[model samples]
Target: DAAHTAMWERLDLDIEAHDALLAVLGKFYGDIYLAQEGRLKGAEYLDFVLSEVHGLRIKELQDAKAAGKKIVGTFCVFVPEELTLAAGAVQVGLCAGAKAGTELAETLVPRNTCDLIKSFIGFKLARICPYTESCDLIVGETTCDGKKKAYEAFGEHVPMHVMEVPQCKAPCDRTLFRAELVRYKEALEQLTGQTITAEALAEATKVVNAKRRALQRLAALRAAEPAPISGRDALLVNQISFYDDPVRFTAKINELCDEIEARITKGQGVAPAKTPRLLLAGCPMAVPNWKLPYLIESSGAVIVGEESCIGARNTRDCTDETPGNLDAMLDALCDRYMKIDCACFTPNTERLDNIAAMARDLKADGVIHYGLLFCQPYAHEAMKVGKAMDAAGIPYLSIETDYGMEDAGQLKTRVEAFVETL
Candidate 1:
């Protein structure tokens, strides 16, 4: 702990504020995660990773830096981890899940900005996120107007690169994305001073695809009647996947899935066989953003699947490794990423179809659409999702809230009532 404190000091973190942030995080994790019963034994790995998310992981990044490896931090799924690896850099997801320096963030962005945008700015202004401090370059993307404009301010605080993500799936869009991939590859090359070769890119694609396959295995296991594992645990695994070493994280997840399969065979689960099963859809729940999931599980329901970017959208499609040359590999990367059904895209009907399909596949009794307060894209899609669910005869509830707990009791009441309907 002393070493970590000294390390944070070296990174110029706000000692008192960061300490307070960790304290709250620890207590929140204890109440939300540690209090669960009949948790899978494999979840111990999740615990260890989260416990050291800022400590050991940050130290590892620092060590990699010492060894001449650059660290690239990204906020969106559009950034290719494969390229980051091929360029000889460590890729990590930056912190943007809690309200740490809202006042400071508001001074830069608007008061009406999405909590996620504000949270990232707050983390940087508060000097509380070691991952942000550890990055050599923080890549931003133009998925929405809010984030695009916010990048103008965020870039002032950190070395930032903005990637243009097309809003529609089209032939020209594919070409645009492919060129953006080249632009990103160039950025990584400049940052790391390493040429991304075809061989290195191919190897990196395999490493990333293996991680996705492991997650896919875990998702399939949740389809078992009683849910062999809890949604909170599964969500944590997904969140940690963004921060952990890709290969080690993949192995650990596969091991966890094996245990889950064994538990399913034994008919053991975190909840009873007939517990109301629910599917969570809509806005991504980043680290420390467990409020809605906690409310759903605590309200006599078990979440079987998450149809958000942080969950299924991220792991649904892996980069095509068939492309051998660097140019073809970039095209494969573009094609795979373009399949994502993020609400930022125009006519994102794929998302509506994907949500209904995931609900049916997981045997979910209902679907709850979560939209963060002030997130226009997801908020707009929520109405469309509700109507589609209505036509399909699946029960649905929509919730919009922020990172603060002031509305927790109110949200729990609505969630409990919705669960009762099933």
Candidate 2:
């Protein structure tokens, strides 16, 4: 909400429009969840899945274009929606429909890059997104150096805007954070050819608050029903808010809930299971760990719940939010995202507690920690979490990944060994 308000102050966008847009974005997620719950077998709209996919993101761009709006599409983690809204352009997060990164992994970038980066860049390199050609500008944020360099190099191919992120560790300063926010503001002004006013900021806060409330409602809905949401559907739903028109999107979610009810009545919603349920907790898990869920199920362990950010991070410890204070809002979000995160966070006594709790709740035989080979946080805490799992007599394993390469051969052996021990 603070981010959205910051954008409104900076962009002077129609607040009602953005609120409606976000609800619709979220609702589209609801629809997608319902569709998958029906066992449709693939992500689709009007019976078409992209041959290369672009879900609500495509809708956001298309919808904006139809209204004669100039919408910019860019990489995740960097291009904040506040900037796009403030600049009078809608920012679409580049989550492609087909998600075919393995081919682009062959060339668009070097092999050492993480699969998430590889697949995303490959999607761009392959031109699966229509917005790629039409984009007036592309922007990148400073969340990862990999993205920074990629955007720096790739900027030559399109109009590029980059957010400067200062290194702030262990209690990032509010003053310094504001300075960075100013830089972000200036970069946005320069890119969008617009100006932000103090009055705009106040109004922007209200608009963003509306969107944040919508997000809260989504979390509330997830907490309802026979757990109306699932891990797979949660991933897709989180993304819809990054795109799509909010008004229509809200209506779509209601339609989705109706569909989900029908599926439940038909007994075709939840996955049938015989194995012990496990909770996979850790970082954004879409990449390599997507396979882990299926693998565990195959090995007679049913994954009944998860705390992965890509899975179920929004389920607990919610905040009642309003957005006049940007830094405080960011901290709240960071703290929330940080809390529901996988074991990827710097291992500490707290991370261990999260694991022990999930194990007890899911009645899990063990917890599986999945992360990339070079991931800094997971490397530091792996042994600690292992110890925690052990002390609780809960079985766990830390599997390092380098996406889709046969490094998985070792992983297969390791997983088999872990399960054997269990």
Q: Any idea what lDDT model 1 has? A: 0.93
lDDT of 1 by residue, 86-181 (tens): 998999987788888999999999999999999999999989999999999999999988899999999999999999999999999888988999
Candidate 1 Cα misplacement greater than 4 A, ranges: none
Which is the leading candidate under lDDT?
1
Candidate 2 lDDT over residue span 209-313, tens digit each: 445444444444432223443545434444454444544444444455555555556555344433344556654554212455545544544454555444344
In angstroms, give how far residue 394 of model 1 lies from its true place: 0.6
**Top-scoring candidate (TM-score):** 1
lDDT of 1 at 121: 96
Question: Which RMSD does model 2 reach against the true structure?
Answer: 9.6
